[model samples]
Target: MKKISILALMMVFGVVANADTLENVKKQGFMKCGVSTGLTGFAEMGADKKWTGLDVDTCRAVAAAVFGDINKVKIVPLTAKERFTALQSGEIDMLARNTTWTQSRDTSLGVNFAGVNYYDGQGFLVSKKSGIKGAKELDGASVCITAGTTTEMNLADYFKTNNMKYKPISYDTADQVQKGFEAGRCDLITSDASQLYSLRTKMKDPSAYFVLPEIISKEPLGPVVRQGDDVWFNIVKWSLNALVTAEEFGVTQKNVDSLAKSSKNPEIRRLLGVEGKMGENLKLDAKWAYNIIKQIGNYGESFERNVGKGSLLKIGRGVNALWSKGGILYSPPFR
Candidate 1:
């Protein structure tokens, strides 16, 4: 008997490598998504205890792409301390918990961020009773902040760089930070600007507090998946790209079907799976992107409904807007 080379044997035996995150997700029948423990407008349980927000929508979009159904997902709420651990341990397939894409996090952690869903910056939320007018006025003030987060480091750097002093009242979770701040254990609470707005609404009197005008540090928040899995990375990356691209081309959910069938634009056609083999490259159905748009809508739509003017947070698009509109959001072509 003649022995064949490994390549020839594979061709003859019809053996294909069987390892990828997509296969695992398919086999499990649901995408395990990590999210914030409870941060409004990003990922929070509503009155009905059902998860809903911008981050949650990111997970749903991935589910729509993989399973052609947005409902096929399991929400794993993790604190700042637990999010990366859960993703690294395979306890969650991906994380969409408004995590910042920093140099250290991207390089040191065994994870890769997909894209910036929202451009944010650190800001302080000061109670009206404190009469704090700006972040600069918080010298020697006690601040409530979550532990094991970039918040602590940024706070220290900001105060140190400004030649100011502060006393930190730290907790392990964002919820505890909010509780501590509200209970007057701290003079102010600091976090991302958008997050501060969301946390403010949780107050008994939402109007009693306001985020300072100063945005101290840049925080480009987005989704993340474990490193070393290009298949999974592509799926998550393109899923986000599809959303932004759909928004750019005006391929909204209400008109996606018509656009997919009758659009004269080649780019829109490719995005909607009317042309191109993008889904094939990702090992998903030809309509993977179409499912994401049809089910979850585009990035703009999700932002508007979850954290933008339409939501309780009422945050402005600002830097989160598309590149054409002067913001930095740019997505790769579908084809």
Candidate 2:
């Protein structure tokens, strides 16, 4: 009986000791990040089998912060219905897909949404020849939309409120919807405006398509991790916050090392791991933010590279701009 009790106690201690995600990641040597199966300009595989996009950047940034090497990440492509389950089942360390933050998702899904990295809204993209001026005009149109997304619910609400009747051609993937819409099986395609832009870019005649002017629902998209892991949650949240704060402080990847050496700003110093115990608090090295910035760059830089003005997506930073610049992209102080 005594031996059995001792063994049971040891097992419990071992389980508790291994529960820290930081420790687990260090032992694993790579962080597993969940991404959309294929959302161009957001999360997709390139010809070289390398992942790139705004969502991919988030995963790389987290990896950089953790292992000091952005390449030390494994991307697991997941569909909308499978993203949450993948995270919850421990199949992925974190999810960086463009998933919306909803109340049910936050509370009932056994996951934690770190923060909103992108402020998006649902909209309709119609062919220019369709002569549909706006979303309000799609009263009785056949809409192609993805299932298991806020787009479906929003479409229902919008049509019901307007007393408009329509048929929803729902699919499980963005590619399916794009193919259906392109085949002329549906009169319109509805999705996040950013997604619509990406899909249109891939269209046979990109110039022939245009997104409607009406913005439907607020879609705060961000990274997600499993619940019951506060340490991992804080690490992910603050890693992203560090990027936003670095941009606000004019700390780019090219200059983060130099700024770390001589920046007199207390916040800058703390953020770059120059003067505070911030990294230690999160069980990371003092140069966590420095690695994130030097390797991944600030949020603005990532956005521009993946989805903003510089990319083929050509999206303007409307609500995604900094808070000081009349947008809602604000982060808490590094201190």
Local distance difference test values of all predictions, in order: 0.88, 0.89
Which lDDT tens digits does candidate 2 get at residues 1-335?
44544323543565333247777888999999999888878998999999999899889888988999999999999888888767765678999989999998899776889998899999999998999897778878999998888889999999999899999998988888999999998999999999999999889999999998998899999999877788889989998998899899999989988898999999999998889899999888989889999998899999998898779998899989999998999999988
Q: lDDT by residue for model 1 over 163-229, one digit each (tens)? A: 9999999887778888898788999998988889988888889999888899888988889987778
Q: What are the TM-scores, per candidate, against the unseen true structure?
A: 0.93, 0.94
Give the number of colliding residue pairs in candidate 2. 0
Candidate 2: minimum summed lDDT over ten consecutive residues — where?
A: 10-19
Candidate closest to the true structure, highest lDDT: 2
lDDT over C-alpha atoms for residue 213 of model 2: 92
Best by TM-score: 2
